[model samples]
Every structure is written in C-alpha cells, then in structure tokens.
Target: MSTVACPDCEARVSLDTPVLNEIVECAECRSELEVLSTDPVVLGRAPEVEEDWGE
Candidate 1:
C-alpha cells in the first residue's frame, strides 16, 4: 500500500485501494479530498499458451 500526504492537512492517504473516483474527508483538517487514481495499478504479462496436442 502507498500513502500520499495531503497538501492541505498532511494526512497519509492510501493509494493502493480499489475504490477510485471518490471523495474523502481529511481526518485532521476535515478537508475534502478527491480520490483520483489507485496506486499499484498495473497489467501483468500475458501467460504462454500451451499446445493441446497430446505428447
């Protein structure tokens, strides 16, 4: 998980969550924070396809 400190309230925000495109309130300053994108978002390499021919 990743955390980004809020510029307004300096709160540690986790960027590794699945919930994106949402608004969150700051615990300290009570400021509204818009969740932009989740962290650790990536695409895995394609797996090799095996042949169906019987050996």
Candidate 2:
C-alpha cells in the first residue's frame, strides 16, 4: 500500500494500487480528495461537482 498526505487535513492516506484521477475521501477531515499523481501518490482537493443546466 502507498501513503499520501491529505491536502485538507494533512493526514496520511493509504491507497492500494492508486490510479490517476482517482477520488478518495479524507478520513480525518472527511474531505474529498483526488489523485493528482501516482508516481509518489500526490493528492489534492477534489473538484466540486457542478450541475450543468440545459443551454
């Protein structure tokens, strides 16, 4: 398993076979996190989902 720091809480987050753009939640802060990179397991805050209105 690989470990990365949470962007929001700075807590250690473990991931098994992490993939790029994988979404995970922070156990300490309960914040959504996204996998920015997999080489060293970099993590960042997940982008908020926005609803698209019909144009």
TM-score of each candidate? 0.49, 0.92
Give per-residue lDDT, candidate 2, residue 17. 88
RMSD of 1: 14.7
Alpha carbon deviation, residue 43, candidate 2 (Å) = 0.3
Residue 29 in model 2: lDDT: 90
Candidate 2's C-alpha lDDT?
Answer: 0.89
Error of 1 at 35 (Å): 0.7
Positional deviation of residue 45's Cα in model 2 after best superposition, in angstroms: 0.6
Tens-digit lDDT track of model 1 for 31-55 = 6666555664322222335898998
**Tens digits of lDDT, candidate 2, 1-55:** 8988888778999999899999999889999999998887899889999888965
Model number with the top TM-score: 2
Worst 10 residues of 2 by lDDT: 46-55
